[model samples]
Target: LYGAHLEGADLSGTHLEWANLSGTHLEGADLGGTHLEGADLGGAYLDGEISFAPAILRGAGARDINLEHIQCETFTEAFGDASVTLPDGYAAGEGKLSHWSPEKLDWENFYEAWRKWQAEQHPDLLPPYYTAED
Candidate 1:
């Protein structure tokens, strides 16, 4: 269905493998758990308006898929293989957006900030279940 208007469609968990959905208008479509392996998404409108609660493309030929319009957050939620072209400044294998990966976080700084906040908010108060440590 090339160039078809499928706006706001609830296509969750649907198997659309090897389908020619090029240039399809999928705005606000619920593609959660949808299997789109080998589907032709070239020119497909899967921008920020759509909900891709993890569409599967494990073995899809996604080299031609244009991800310029797709949001990084939404794309990260999906499962893709090496064929899928990720947006610039992103990489696979982290199970999360590359920029937001745990390795990139400053845990020490965050812990210090949290400690300061806790000391200021509750100087002498600790929850009964929370055991304080030296």
Candidate 2:
């Protein structure tokens, strides 16, 4: 699911184990009980009214996730497992954070920034948008 546009998608109970979902946009996505074990969500966009209505993230690698953007009763109910790779705020089992509105997150800017981040991270690699031979 690399670089896929899944904005506001209902991805409940989807089996995405060990999949490479890098640079995917998941803003406002319904992730209720979505199995994300071992999934790589690096640079994926989750900054909006996301439904962790009760999601799963065991052993998943999630980077750059602004936990403040994910809407849930608490951080634990929305995410799980200490092994799951998350940002500094929600990386501990004893940690707990409350939900907040989407007034602070800038989705458009975040998405664009991720693209540039990828370029910087991998200088030799070319994005499909730029390397197409057509």
Against the true structure, what is every candidate's RMSD?
Answer: 16.1, 10.9
Local error of candidate 1 at residue 32 (angstroms)? 0.3
Report the C-alpha lDDT of model 2 over 1-134, residue by residue, as the tens digit: 99999999999999876566778888888888887654656667776577865666544444445555554333432223232334445433343522211122244443343334334543233233443221
> What is candidate 1's lDDT per residue for 81-109, written digit by digit as tens?
33345677665445463222222224344
Indicate the worst ten consecutive residues by lDDT in candidate 1.
Answer: 98-107
**In angstroms, what RMSD does candidate 2 have relative to the true structure?**
10.9
Q: Candidate 2 at 110: error in angstroms?
A: 20
Backbone collision count in every prediction? Answer: 1, 0
Candidate 2, TM-score vs. the true structure?
0.54
